[model samples]
Target: MTITEELINKINVCTKCSLHKGRTHAVPGEGSYNAEIMFIGEGPGRDEDLQGKPFVGASGKLLTELIKSIGLSRDDVFIANVVKCRPPENRDPLPEEIAACWPYLDQQVRIIKPLLIVTLGKHSMGRFLPGLKISDVHGQPKRAKGIFNERQVYLPLYHPAVALYDPRKKDILFEDFKKIPLILKQIKKSKNDIQ
Candidate 1:
């Protein structure tokens, strides 16, 4: 089996962290194995936990809309979470849980080698661009060295969940979504120029 498939199989039965105890299903993430873009989120929510999929709830709906705005579908990019399992009551994942699960995320990045990584929330952003305020950096592209591969481009976007709680951020999120195509083009041009 492919490394990604093996990793998912392991994750399916993972109990390294206590979060696994409460999980209905481990969302190991899904998308093209050779996608150019990847979207990473914090963790699974209610619908996601129940369905063993990422971004399958209200936030997922908004995420789909945002992806569509950029002329892409859910299948166009890889989508995963920092933590594979849902936290109790949908609370923020504890640092230990994040620590336990990050290697899997790192492996996903290594295998996919996406040209652009769109961090869908602050937690996901912290993985690549640490200590920067998401408020200041939302939609900003940062050159980040990959955990298991070479340097790559990272873009931090507000999690779609934010709009659900506070609709004011929707415009900011939409504006950020609009910037993705241009950003990908620039990355492609730079890569071709180097080659």
Candidate 2:
């Protein structure tokens, strides 16, 4: 099997943490294996857990629209989560749960080597850029060391779910989404310049 497939298989049967016990299916993420951009979210919700897909609910619909706004489709980017399984009652994943699933996500990053990782919420953002408030940093891109790669680029954004509760956040998210193409272009240019 291909490496990505192997990883997914491992995730599917994972019992590294308590979160596994309640899952209907593990969401190992989806989309292009060779994508330039990877969107990482907090974790699976009820719909995602049942469907075994990332971002397939209402928030997912918004995420889809955001991706389209950038002139790309779900097929063009990778979508994954901090934890493969759903947290109980859609609660935030505990630190221990996140720790248990870290290896899988780390492996994914190494395999995809995406040029940019877009963190879709605080949990995903905290994993990379810890202690930073999403409100203070959303839409700004920063280069930092990731679990596997040095100089990884990350853009933090409020979780799409937030917009559902607050209409003002929806406007902010759209504005932030607009920065993606420019960020990608800048990352590509910088890489070429270095080469």
Best of the candidates, TM-score? 2
User: Model 2 misses residue 149 by how many Å?
Assistant: 2.8
**RMSD to truth, every model:** 2.4, 2.2
Q: Give the best candidate by lDDT.
A: 2
- Across 1-195, the per-residue lDDT of candidate 1 in tens digits comes to 978789999999999999999999999999988899999999999999999999999999999898899888999899999999999999999999999998899888889989889998888898788898999989888886777545678899899999888877998999988988888898988863211
Candidate 1 regions with alpha-carbon error over 4 angstroms: 191-195
14: Cα error in model 1, Å? 0.5
Off by over 4 Å in 2: 191-195
> 174 in model 1: Cα distance from truth in Å?
0.8
Q: Distance from true position, residue 53, model 1, in Å?
A: 0.4
**Candidate 1, TM-score vs. the true structure?**
0.95
